[model samples]
Target: MEAYWRRTAMWYGGVGLLAARVVRNLALPPAYTRLVVREMELMGVRSLGVAMIAAVFTGMVFALQSAANMARFGAEAYVGPVTALAILRELGPVLTAILVGGKVASGITAELGSMKVTEQIDALRALGVNYVKRLIVPRLLAALLVFPLITALADLIGLLGGAAIMFFERRADPWTYWNVTTYWVLPRDFLMGIAKSVVFGVLVTLIGCYNGLETEGGTEGLGRATTATVVHVTMAVIVSDFFLTKLLLALFW
Candidate 1:
């Protein structure tokens, strides 16, 4: 038990150091603008379709389930507000972050782990290049910029999906559903979700890069790092969500 706690503390400390380095590097004129742009394309633009699909389905399912229960009490009309609140305040950002973590973080770990095992990272250092700045900064910046955009998109699409269900399945009037949704969902709710998404984005990229940079044991280690990145990012997002939700409620509600 002592060893386990020690290792955990060390892991977090290392990640924190990496995060500090990333922040410092970000302030400098990017030495790898092209890489940052490419990463944004891969992590943001390429991932949008998948995030949208997941969000729409999540909203549809929430509406369907909530409507079924609310109808028992003839309160089906309230489903709009319930669904909207769930999507905007919780599901939109959390689900999008998890989805991106699986897709982007895993890929980052695998790519960087391979480079480490191949000693390409060492080669960059030997050439007097700051590998962290060239590699980690781009991914960090891309994730920071991309996740909020994706979360916003997911929030909008999720609401639309819920609204559609309210219209077609529940036979609620469109305007009434819209009004109820808007009435319950404040700008603060939207901002809170987006803020959580930004934190998640930074953590995901940092974890991935940390695992990748520390990879060992050649191909097998690369595989392990990739797997670890996915697991860690998912857990981090969920665990952080609880605290962030609590804080947001205290501050905004």
Candidate 2:
């Protein structure tokens, strides 16, 4: 128990320190523009297809299930609003974060772990270069900038998926479905969801980088750290979502 708590404390402390350094050194140089653009392509453009597919399926499922339940209660017409509310407020952000955590976070860990084990990171340090500024900053900034966009895209695609279900499955008019959905969903809800995505982006990148930096034991350790990065980021996003949701509700409601 003592060792467990000690390890946990060390992990958190390391992550906190990394976050502080990233924030302090956030000023971008002209040269870093290329790096940031590369990261944006890798993290944002590459992940779009998967995120969209997940959003569509999720919204379809939610609409189908909710429509059934609402029909039983003679409130089928309200299904559009309920589906939009749920997707925009919670599912879009959380699901997109989870997908990004699994894909991008794992890749970050693996790439960094490989570099660490190969002594490339130390080589940079030997050359008097700040690896954190050169490597971590670009990825972090990419995540921060791209995640909210992804979340918004997911929310929009998810709404379209729900609208499809309402029209085809529920036999509701397309215009009516969208009207109700837009009427019921407030701007604050959309903003709050985007806010959650931003926080999630920070968590995913930070956790991935920390695990990669701390990896040991050579090749075996690299694999372990990569796996651990995915697990830790997924858990962190989920746990944080609960608290963020409550806080947003208190602030907005």
Candidate 3:
């Protein structure tokens, strides 16, 4: 058990160090630029529709649930604040991160792992290319930038979803929702959500790429790394959410 724990810690630590080095030295070479653009297409544009749909449905569900609960206590006026706070601080980034983590991380792991197993990475190395900078850096940059953008979009869509529920489904005056949103929702919530999304983006990219690059033992190993990438990124997202929440509450609330 101790040996297992030690190896696990070292694995994570080594990956963290490698990622830190890569991020610190990030310079957009021409090929890297092309790769980043391609990744943006895959990570951002590809996932937009799913993120929008998920955000809308989640917002609707939150509003309906909150309304039902608040109705019992004659606290329906608080619905707008509730919905806004939930979407801005919690749901938007968290949901968006999950979506991106699954999509981007899995794809990256599979792709890189395949390259590793097929001797493509070896070929790059033999040809005197910087594999980390050429491959990992561009994708990392794309995921980091795109995840936060998606989170912002999700927040807006979620707010709209909640507004629809309040105005159409619950028969509340639209002004009530708008008024409460304008008055009660704090700007810090928006900042916190975006910050959280940025951290999640970093986590997803680093873990996914690390797993892919480290893959061994051929096909089965690639499959294992892909699974591990998703699981690790998801867990990291949840953990980061908790810490960010605590920090925000301490500093802002």
The order by descending lDDT is: 2, 1, 3
The local distance difference test score of each candidate is: 0.90, 0.91, 0.89
TM-score (all chains, Cα) for each model = 0.96, 0.97, 0.95
lDDT of 3 by residue, 1-253 (tens): 9999998998889788978778665864545678889999999999999899999999999999999999999999999999999999999999889876788899998999999999999999999888888888888788778988999999999999988999999999887679877898878889899989888888888888888888998999998989888888888899889998998789888
Mark the regions of model 1 whose C-alpha exceeds 4 Å error after superposition.
none
Lowest lDDT sum, 10 consecutive residues, model 1, at 22-31
Model 2 C-alpha lDDT per residue in residues 1-253, reported as the tens digit of each score = 9999999999999999999999877874535988989999999999999999999999999999999998998999899889988998899999999997679988998899889999999999999888999989999999999999999999999988988888988799888777877788889989999999999999999999999888899999999999898889989999999999999999889
Model 2 residue-pair collision total: 0
CA shift of 80, model 2, Å: 0.6
lDDT tens digits, residue span 1-253, model 1 = 9999998898899999999888787777646889889999999999999999999999999999999999999988789889988988899999999998789999998998999999999999999888889999999888889999999999999988988888888788998888877787788888889999999999899998999999999998888888888899999999999999999889877
Per-residue lDDT, model 1, residue 205, is 93
> With candidate 1 superimposed using the best TM-score fit, by how many Å does residue 142's alpha carbon deviate from the native?
0.9
RMSD of each: 1.2, 1.1, 1.5
